[model samples]
Target: MRKPHFELPLHFMLLPPVIIVLIYSYGPILGLVIAFQRYVPAKGISGSEWVGLDQFKYVFSLPDTMNVIMNTLSISVMKLAAGLVVPIAVALMLNEVRKHVFKRLVQTFIYFPYFLSWVLLGGILIDILSPERGVVNAMLGWVGVEPIYFLGDNGWFRYVLVITNEWKEFGFSTIVYLAALTGINPTLYEAAVIDGANRWRQTWHVTLPGIRPIIVLLMTLALGQVLNAGFDQVLNLYSPQVYESGDIIDTMVYRMGLLDAQFSVAAAVGLFKSAISLLLISVAYYLAYRLVHYRIF
Candidate 1:
């Protein structure tokens, strides 16, 4: 009885945050009814006409639907691939550095961009990649090449998105991998060297094997983000000219819901995306548990 009473203050301290989560998170679920209704702002949720599956039908029927789906998949998949490979490569390179000061300086320089918001970076990228009067194009001219509009060009936009996303995130992921590398026993390397293994052989046999679990875990968890094409980044960096290659689900929903005032259809698309994400996340967790013995509990 005394044990329960002793924890009362701790329980009270946790109550406010619990209430906030319930209000902000669960409360919005009521708005999901908009997905099945012809929602009208003037009429509100209670008065909105129930349209059943019509909104979803309209969403799938849109001419942009398949293109949006393809765009989302392409960008996200490329991002995931780069996110995995680039970090591992960088981490391995850093691990080979002998000087602590130089290694820390390089880490700081690369990781600096991870702290910058897309809003700021977008402006910087736009200026640097401007078709005219931009540093990138200026450098291209030094080699007698014509100016290239990186952000506006359709064929190049997706690649730019992937490369830039990696630039901003890979440093952080590299740090993660470096931490994993440190966890590998130094004796493992010694054992490999004792077997006449060289640096490359030791790295291949010991270092990579040590980080394999984290790599697999990251890959499995990334499955849930297949539909996320980075809305903030695309919104800031893209224009109408690149919409053919850059437009994704979240941006499409933004245009439909806010710009076009097609709220019900937007809600339908959002709900559809959420359902798929939930499934993928569940599958990802299950695979993680099976493959790497990873579990939240």
Candidate 2:
């Protein structure tokens, strides 16, 4: 029998990421103690007065807390649903395109937006969505429709968040589906055609099932972010006018912790969001394994 060789150089290459994770990710966990204290910057974590569950109590007592939670869940769920469907549809359509140049051009154009930061996109959206002279409003004016205040109106803000998020992200998401589509057995499609199955039938029976594992994986990962409703995008685009619809848990934490200088309350809210995300990830993992027999690990 041959003895296996250990790759010492490869092991050395992994050390930097391990060190960074220890310094950044795992090291910050000790600060979670602030959530249980009336944290003061001058007093420090150890010197701060311990208040136990008081911070959490205060968080739950606020009337805005429920609204924030609802907004976060609603926006996240809408983004997740749209994220999944649009990418899959686009990937399927792209798969049917025989012209390589056109397909590649489309993919390039779509994928480019994902690389642009929300800060940049938010600025562009502000100009494009401007009620007075924006392109969207200008188009509406041409159609004899009233100019919609997309970012300012409470009724339309959440929809804007969902739609814009999907538009920016779907291209990157499609890459995963396209990769899965490539992995599908070509013989399966040939067999489907032999059975008199049309393009739609072949897609329904073969292509979807071929990518089911990837779909389940993406969905499970999305569940882990059920509370994260794009803080950067929302913060950049929303004004006081749409706060009723756009204020999410993360933005609340930013205001309470950083702006208001209530570190304890911020920590408490952060801990709550983390707990919910952890619970969701665990449940998603269990469901994926039990129902679909898919294991991310």
Candidate 3:
């Protein structure tokens, strides 16, 4: 019998990524100690005095923390719902259309937004939604309705965030659904047609079932990011006027840590958020596996 032996050089293939992961990913985790200590950049991580959970204590003591968490969850959940539904719906709609040129044009237009940075979109959004001179306001004027303050109003801020996020990201999600849609065997449609099934029924029984697994997988991955409510978008689009409804955990961390220079408190808040996200992701992954028998790794 031949001896079971692994190729030595094959193992070397993993070394570069392992080293990169350690340097880039694991290296930053070591700085998590700052969550327990009042870290000064000059004094360094070693010199900082430990304050234990006092940072966490301060975090919960704030009245705004509840609002911040609420904003984060609300916006994230809304975005997730929109992102999941709209893309699938759009893909289905596109699939129904017979004109290849029109379909491709629509796809290109939708996907264009995904490539635009929040910085660029922020200015465009502000210009389009500006109360005095915005296109939206002008349209509302034509309809004899009052112009709404989308960015400044606390009540509308979170809604706008969700909408803007969806507008930017829905195209990417649509691409995934479109890919999944294409993978569906055409024979299923032919068989359905032979059985006298119409387009609606064929889609219901064949297309949806074919893409259901991909949908579940995407949802599982999205659930892992429930806490990340678009830091860049929120940071750019929001102002002090709407902080009550617009301030997410990431923006709050940015403000407290970088702007206010409260390193320990910021780190503690970040660590707490990360822990919750990990817990949520684990639960979501397990549930997904139970439901669909899938694993990412």
Error of 1 at 295 (Å): 1.2
lDDT of 2 by residue, 1-297 (tens): 999999999999999999999999999999999999999899899899999999999999999999999999999999999998999999999999999999999999999989999999999999999999899999999989999999999999999999999889999999989999999999999999999999999999999999998898889777888888999989899888987999999999999988999989999999999999899989888877876787767
lDDT of 3 by residue, 1-297 (tens): 999999889889989999999999999999999999978899999998888988899999999999899989999999899988899999999999899999999999999999999999999999998999999999999989999999999988888998888899899988889989999999999999999999899989999999999898889878989999999999889999999889999999999989999988999999999999999899888978987888778
TM-score computed on alpha carbons, candidate 2: 0.93
Write down the TM-score for model 1. 0.97
After superposition, which runs of candidate 3 have C-alpha atoms over 4 Å from their true positions? 1-19
- The predictions' CA RMSDs to the true structure, in order, are 1.3, 2.3, 2.2
- For residue 96, give model 3's deviation from the true position in Å: 0.8
| Structural similarity to truth (TM-score) of each candidate | 0.97, 0.93, 0.92
Query: What are the runs in model 2 whose C-alpha is more than 4 Å off?
Result: 1-15
